[model samples]
Structures are given as structure tokens and as C-alpha cells.
Target: MSAMYGHRAKRFPKLPEHRRDQQIPDAFRTTMAGEYFMLGQSASRHILVLATSSNIRLMATRRTWALDGTFKIVPQWYQQLFTIHAFAAGKLLPLVYCLCTDKDIGTYGFKSQALIIRAAALEVDLNPDTNICDFETALIPAIQGYFPNARAVHRIAGELGLKTRYRQHEETRRKIRMLLATAFLPVPHVNTGVSLLEAGTTGTLAALFQYFRQEWMTDERLPLWNVHNIRTNNHLEGWHNRLNRKAGKSHNGLYELLQLLIAEQGVMDTLIQQVLSGNAAVGDLRRVNKVYAQKQRQVARYTGEYTNVRRTLKQFLEALIRVRAAMYGHRAKRFPRLSEHRHDLVLADQFKTTKSGEDFLLCQSNCRHILVFATGTNIRLLAACRTWGMDGTFKIVPQWYQQLFTIHAFVAGKLVPAVYCLCTGKDIGTYGYIFQALIDKAAVLEVDLNPDTIICDFETALIPAIRGYFPNTRVQGCYFHFCQAVHRKVGELGLKTRYRQHEETRRKIRMLLATAFLPVPHVNTGVSLLEAGTTGTLAALFQYFRQEWMTDERLPLWNVHSVNIRTNNHLEGWHNRLNRKAGKCHNGFYEQFHILIAEQGVMDTLIQQVLSGNVTVGDLRRVNRVYAQKQRRVAQYTGEYTNGRRTLEQFLAALMYLTPEPI
Candidate 1:
């Protein structure tokens, strides 16, 4: 029997099927099943008590059970018992062949039924009386029975006087360990420098000495050149370990797994594209030449005049190729393979519209120049201009490198240009790279750098380039650039005073500048000027040029007659107008550079009309006044100027008459 316990407790709880919910005496219900608390317990917890209360309940109604060659049919409560009986019987087959027949005190009685079931699942058995260890402890040895042939055959061969293969297996393991250790050692040094040796023998010591001596003898200035090399096997092992952790345990192989890793970290190709878009250098070739010059300066011995350094120069050229491949094609490995999607792609023939309504296309004909203009906008489209100083422009490199250095002028958080130079064959020398075929063909041409006038807001690099190329040109700093520089200087001085208070201080500085000889000691103190003839020098000149005429009395503001008078507010207002017209996100530097030129062209015409005193507010107000319901703000702000023929004495007398001295 299956160790039946508390028979009286099981038997005395029986109740007729129809009397399941009958109200019985409290004492009888509480005392039923030999437990006094049965009556107080909730119905859910009292299920086991109720099941034992009646035999008909155990055999109750039709409960669905389907057997498809898996197990014997049994009552719901007895199914587990039946399965245990079957398993126990199978394990003890060599010991017993008889099947249990009696229903009472029967059904595989005296068996450790739970143990038998577990043993069968694990494919192992233990004595019923002996307490077996837990599943975790016994699982490995128990599972070994499932593949019994491998174990049993080995045992049989050992008993039958046949030698075991254990020694041979150990030898194989030793060979594998030796191979791995050897592979872990450093390989022959490919490129010579500081290197880790597999064996620190006399040969390695001599080789290191030779390498240093060779470098010292060849390039005497740079004696200690540091070089490092990582073995491929070790590098690969580390990479694989990192990849496994990134992928987790779910990923099975490298093919799909690498894609996930690439996606997470971002593909080199996508990063290269991002860098290209921001780079103003990618389309300019002169920049590449400058880079070559810089490299030549650094390793002068390696790059001597033409012949002596030919091989070294070729090596450097190869390095440049590697850099360009990584930047343009996302090729890091020597054997570069582009995706089918990339290979199948065709160059986009369509043009992108810029903020100023100019159509822009990539200029592939010449990488050195960027073209910007609008069609039929002016006599000849004024081109946008910016130049790169290295191969990064023409040869191609990481887009990030380009983005870091590319200059874009923004006003009121919008893109703008300080100036646009319209160039032709007559001004080719003044406008660099305009002769290039792509710029010539472009509806809007872009001049790399203009020599005629140096803009105030020109890039730091462009400043020197302009000075070098156009020695005699009037390099005017834009009024905006001058103001910014002043503000920066003021901030550096820790002057916390507001701009209003600073106005007088600024005017005194500005007026002192107008006088050829500066009498202000404070302004000249610790200041340096290139030419002594100029009062305060270029620095003061730059400050005075940026004067805003609306409120500043320092310098005479822009007058129609003045050829090149400047106002900082003019460029600010002009940039604001362009941004208000086109406020969409900029797609790329090249496109924005072009749009700025087109906007400048329209603005130039407007400025010309205002300068000529011909711009009228009536026409603009008449059109938009209905909806806007307001007059147009004056298109221009001018100082009070009467046709002056009076002498300073007459002006002083009039001023004196208006207000006599306070005393």
C-alpha cells in the first residue's frame, strides 16, 4: 500500500452528494476530518477536506482526458499515482513481472512512487529506504545513463584486456595547449618601432637597438618615434568577447550578430556620410595641397625636394588613400566591399532648394570650389565664397573633421553670409577657383576666396590667406565682426557694466579714432599698432568700423556719398530677412553656402535703392496695410543732415544762443 495515514480522518468526512451545502451541527462540521478548524476555514482552503469527504466527488462528472499513446487513463486525482506506478514497474522489471490486481490496499503498493517517477525521468534509480540526494546533486550522473552505450562499452573494453585511449586523449589536449600558447606570442615585427618580443633574447635586443639607431641617424631631430603593434589573434579574441556580451546569449553566429553590433554602435559608413555633410572642405582641392605642405614641414627629412624622398612620399600618399577611403567609402579594411545597396545607387540628378530659393547640386567637376547663386537675379550671379586649406576638401575625409572647421554665419539663430562676391573672368585672380568648370557651369557660381576686398567676418584661416594673396586689397572687417571682438575684449576685462553705460566709453574711443593722432592715453596704453602713422592702429580701426550709426555718435554713419562706409546693423538686418523667408533646417553646408549668396544678391539691390534715397514706404505699405493694418517701418534710418554751408563759429553761436552757459 502507498503508506496510507489517518484512515479515520479520511473515512469520517464523507457526505452524500445532495447534502454538500446542508446546515449541520457546528460541533459535527468543525470536528469532521479529525480537524476542529475545518468549519472556520474558507471554502478555497477547504478543497482537500471536501474531496476526502465523499467517494462520489472523487469520481464525480465527465472531465476531459485525451490519451495519444502517452499515458494510461486514471481518475484526475490518481493520474500522477498511475504514472509513478508505471515507471516504478519498468525500473523493477528484472526484479518483478507480476502486476497488482487488488483495488483496496493495492495499485503498486509499498513503492516510493515519487522517487520512481523522478528516477525514470532522470533515467536512474536508488533504494527506497536510502534517502537519495537532491536533483541538482544527482542530475549529471543520472543523465549519463541516457547515453549508456558510451560508458558501458568503455567499462567493458577495460575489463576485456583492451588498452584505454586516455593517454592518447591527454596527448591531444597537450598539443592544443602548446599551439594556443605559441599563437599568443608576438609574431615577427612588420613595421619597426617599440615592439614586444616573443622571446627577449640577444637577437631581439640587437634588433631594437638597430631600429632606434636607424631612426636617430636618418631623422636626427626626432630620435624617439613611438610605434605599437597588437597581434591579430589577441585583438580578435577581445573583439569576440565584447561582441558576445553585446549580443547576449540569444545570437548564434557572426553574420547577423555583426549587423546588430554595427547598428548599435553606428556603421562607419553612416558616420562617414554625416561627417561629409558638415565638412566644407570635401569639395575643395587647394586645402589638400596645404595639408601636404604641413606634413612636409613636420617630416622634412622624409620629404626632401622631389627625388630623395620619393619612396617616403609614395608611402605618405598611400596613407592618404587609406584616410580618404575611410572617409568617403567607409573602407577601414584593405579589402573594401561596399554593400549592394550602395553599389546599385545612382547619383541624384535632381537639385535641392536652399533657404533663399536657390537650386543646389553637388559640384563634382571641381572639389575645390562651392557655387552659390540664383538665376536671373542680377547682372551676373554673385557667388558665395569659402576655401579649404588641405586635402580634406578635395581628397575626402571624415565628415566630422569637415563639420568641426566649416564656417556658417547665423543671425537671430538663423544662417546668413557676411558678403557675396560676384566674380567673372576679369576678376579670376581676385576670386579663387571660379575658373573651375563646375563653378562656370553652375547657375550660381561660388568663388573660393576673393582678393578684391577682405570681409570683416572672414574665417580665421581665410584672413591670413587673403593677406598673403591680396596684399594691396582693402581687407575690411565686417561691422558685426568688430562688435563681437569688442564685446569679447570687454568681457575679458571683467567689465560687468551694461551696454547703455558703455556707449559713452565706446563713443569717446570711436571719436578718438577719427582724429589722426590719438590723444587718449588710456586707449593707447599697452596697445600695439603696425604703422605709427595710423593713430591707434588696425585694432582701433576695426573697432571704429563696427560703429552702429542709429545710436552711436562715434563715427559718421553710412552716407550715400561714402564709398565703403559700414554699419554693423545692416548685416544683422539683412541676415534676419533671409532667415525669416526660409527657416527650414539646413541640409548641408554646401547648400546653405549657396543660398546665402542668392539672398545676398536680392539684399544688395535693396541696399542700393535705400542708399540712393529712392526706396519708398508707400508702395510696400499700400499692399500689406490692409491685412497687417499698419504702415511699413522705415526702410532706412538716416542722420539729420541739412545742406551745410555754415562755419563752426556760426554753429557754436547758434548752440550758445539756444542755451547760455549755466553760470
Candidate 2:
């Protein structure tokens, strides 16, 4: 009793004469003595058993120690302490200060405060500055100094390197501490003080993380410098918590925690392997199913139909019951029913057959129009190919295009988009009018554009009328028309040879421009190739080109101009996504098609940004710069120009002019 509070004031006294007549029974006292001795023996024996474990010994010797807290005394004890402290000190300290300084007081705060005020008050006041220094310099040590029993116990523990024993009922508390520490390794250890440890259970992992950075590791260099070292091996925690909570009445909680940790690790390893095998979504689904199975077994006692409340039990219990059912339940429902197939739909959707007869869902394709729809990030290609010829009835609607544009507002900090139209087998004029209606609707919606922007389409004669209405716009002939004109002008064989020559010229252009970054001497071979107008397919392709193509400043634009402006690959890609929903059975999209396409564009844009690494890709940064630069160089044409010089300030001004306003 004295050890509990550290002040030796009152002791139990002998009974008075009248009470002596009603003497205490020897049998009752003996029974009480035996029970108390047995309780003490059990506690000591349990501690000894922990000490005997090799794992415990090894952990104790290590410098690292995981700390946690458990409530020890009841609320009545709290009330008693408050009354006693108030009686001695005349009043409780201001509640705000009491709350604020409460954390600073560690274990045995009552004993420490009592001794400091009574026994050590004179020594402390004799030299206020020195005592304050002692108080501040070693607050934790001073608290321990006031209680001889606690100090002795802690000294023995520190000397022997004894790992503190956790309360039997508080294993969850200890595990939480260990899990948090492991997740944030190489970070300075968390305080593990009573308040912080208790806070971990209720707070989010992110909140605890911020707290660790701000409170525990107060060094200025903290968090920013040490962020990379923090390890988040939370897979075990996820599995353990699920399994522990799922443990049936038959199973011990401690054994379930350990067993589930082991099982969860195995399952995660398998799932990761499946993902690496190219079915990550499917693999995740499979793991989810397995967890459900385990939960079913754990909850088998409430065996009921899918429609029953038992079946509706949450995943934590459901997984345990399912696992047990799969393993040992004789009367439980067997394999998942056919209706379960709907649950697997999302996973099944992720799988596809490769061209080589392999079961791979994700494979790169050659057709750019269809390809961009799947991978999402092809705005530059979309814009360039808008003029290409598309034989199908698929079309681009203006209203939908504006909606798509609004969704993507920015791509890697640039504004680029594909044209939109309706598919029609009606004459070009009729199709053109349909596009006009969409444009009018877009205007009503107040869709913002460059005002100077020009949209060109297959309705060649209509371009001038559209441009007349929007004077800032200039309509360019579709590359699709130009490519078709070239074939009509030549023959099929000639068209094939011309295409091959075009590729060769592009390759030579790249080689010539390779060292241009350094401003070195030009290669004679490159110069010769540029000057010589040889009688081959390459020369024929460029034979009747505009004077703009001859200029140095416009040369880069020329390469893409033929592929995009001359052809309609850009518009065709949008048609393909819309057509995919309709398939060959339908000639054109119905009313729902417009909204679906618009919504799909939003999804694809987000996917593209993710793939391009404008945002961090799972902690990796700047992942797209090298790829973007390479693609830019490979896709463009280049030649030396006579008068293309502009100062950096002028360039910046021009860039600002070209940039889009924020939505």
C-alpha cells in the first residue's frame, strides 16, 4: 500500500473493545492470504515463462524496445487521488495547465508530485535556478527519483535489459505499437508514451505519421530528410487485424493473430506473383475471394443463405467463417454458386487473349486510332490525325468535343484535344450541318476556345463558312483528303512505294538533327539528301507541296502535317471508341452514346495523366520527360531556316499567347 503512493502516513489499526468481541475469523483470513499469494505467484510465473523464451531474450538485448500503455487502476482511484492531492495542495492546478503538463508527467505522477511538494520542497527552493535546471534537464529522471520503488524497479530493468511485459488482456495494444514502429522504420522511435500509444488506436495512420514527425522527431531536418527511410509494411497489419477479429469462439485470439499474420503473408506473396504475371486486377479479386472463404469458416456457426443476416456479416467475420467452411465445415454450403459469377465480372473483364494466342489482356497495338482509346494519352496524335480519311460512318460531334476538352482541361500542363462529330452515311453537307448544330450548342454552353482556333473537317466547302463566322479561325485542308488525293493521283503500287520513301526521309532527318543541339557543322550527306530531288516515291510525295513546306520554320510542321492534317487518324480514333460500344451490329451511336463518350473521355484523360507521370507514379517522379522528348523528336521533321530567330522574351510572350486559359 505504501509502495503504491510513496507516502507512509496511515496504517490499519487494531479493532476497539466492542469490535474485538466480533473478532475476525481465522479461516476467512487464511483463504484471503492464500488467494493473494496465488495471484502473486501466477504473475511471477508468467513473467518467468516470458523470460525463458529465446525470442524474448534476444528482443530484450536489442537497443530497440516497443512501448505501449494499458489502464491499470479504476475511476474510483482517480477520484481519490484528486481529493487527496486537492486536500494537500489546497486546490488542483488550473485544469488547463493540469491537462497541458499531464503528458510531461510519466509513470507514478502522483508519487512524484507528492514528494517534490513535501519532502524535496526546501531543497528545490534553496536555489530556484539550479532546481529549475534539474527539473527541465531531466524531467523523466526526476519523476522516477521521487518514488524509490519505481526507481529501483526501472534501474533493475535497465541494467538487465529486461523487455517490459505487456498485460495479458492488452496484447492488441502492444501489437499496435510494434506495427506502427515497423511501418515507420529508421525514423526516430515514437514516444510510445501513454497518450500517444492510446491515440494510435483511434487515429488514422496518416495522423499518427504527422504526429511522429512533429512531436517525436522535432529536429529541423526531420520528415523531409528521413521520409524515404520510413517503411510501410502494412500488409501484415491488414491481414492480422482481419484474422484476429475473425477468430471463432473456438480459437484463441493470440494464436489467431499469429496464424493469420503468417497466412496473410503467403496469400499476399501469391497475389503479387499473379499480378506480375499480368493479371493484377484479377489477382486482387482472387485474394479477396480467399479472404471471404476464411471469414466464412470463422462465422460458420451462423450458417445461413446468402439472403440471410448471417451471410450479410461483414468481411472480417465472413472471411474467417468461409475459410473454416472450406477446410472443415461439413454442413456449410460448398463451392460458390453460379450467381457468384457476377461478383467475378470485374476481374474477368481485366483478362484478354494476346495476338500470339497468349492469355495477356494488355498488349500494344499498331492501329493508332483504336490504340489511343485504350491507353488514353494521345492528345498530340489525336490533334495531328484529325484530318485523316476514315471510311466508316463514325463522326466527331462538336458538343461532345467541348465536353471532353472541359474534362481534360490540362495534359502535362498543355491544352490539346481530338475533334468530335456524328457518324453519317448521308452526304457531306448533311454531316456538316449536324456538326454545325453541335457547334451552336457548344456556343450556347459558353465553351471557351482560342477564339482564333480553326477547326477543319471533310466538308471542304463548308470550312470557309465556319471560318467566316469565327474570324480568328483559319481552316486547313484535312490530311485525310490530301493522302486520298495522292493515291487517286497515283496508283496503288505507287502509293506503297511513296509511303516507304517517306519513312526513310524521316529517319535521315532524325540522323541529321541528332547533333544539332550542339550547333556543330552540318553533315554533307544530310545536306545532299535535302538538296537532291531524286525521282523516287519520297520526291513524288512532296512533289506538289505548298511553299510553306519549303521554309525552314515550317519544316517540322510538314512531317506531322502529312500524317495528321492530310489524313483523318485523329478523328477516326474517337469514332472507334464510340463504335466499340455500338459494334458492327449498329450503324451509328444512339442518344446514350454521346454522354457515354463524354464520360469515357474524362476517364481516359485521368488514366493518361497517371501513365505519363505528371503526378507521382507510386512514389516515382518525372517518369515521362525522357519518353516525351524522344517521341517528340521521332515524330517531327526538321531543317535549317533563314529567318526564324526570336529573343527569349519574345518566345515567352508567344508561348503565353498560345497557352489556354484555365477552366
What's the TM-score of every candidate structure? 0.25, 0.25
| Residue 167 of model 2, lDDT score | 23
For model 1, what is the error of residue 255's alpha carbon versus the real structure, in angstroms, after optimal superposition? Answer: 61
Candidate 1 Cα outliers beyond 4 Å, as residue runs: 1-347, 352-362, 365-379, 383-431, 434-458, 463-474, 496-507, 510-663
What's the lDDT for candidate 1? Answer: 0.28
lDDT, model 2, position 210 = 56
For candidate 1, the TM-score is 0.25
For 1-663, candidate 2 gives per-residue lDDT tens digits of 112212211222222222113232232222211311000111211110001111122222222111111111111111111101000011110000010112234423543353234323233321111110111223435433553322110110111111232222244434334333222223343233223444545434345445554643454323322211211212222322333234422223222222332343344344333333545453334334455445444434343332254343232233432343456443223222222222222212212321222222122112211111211122222222212222333223221121111111222323233233332223434334433543444444454233322333445345444454444543444433433443443353254433334654433322322212211122223334443664565455444332423344323322222121222444444444444444232221122233444544554544455445555433323444543443343233222121235432222222222111111
Please count the clashing residue pairs in each candidate, in the order shown.
17, 41
Candidate 2 overall lDDT versus native = 0.29
Off by over 4 Å in 2: 1-450, 454-462, 476-533, 536-571, 585-627, 631-663
lDDT of 1 at 576: 38
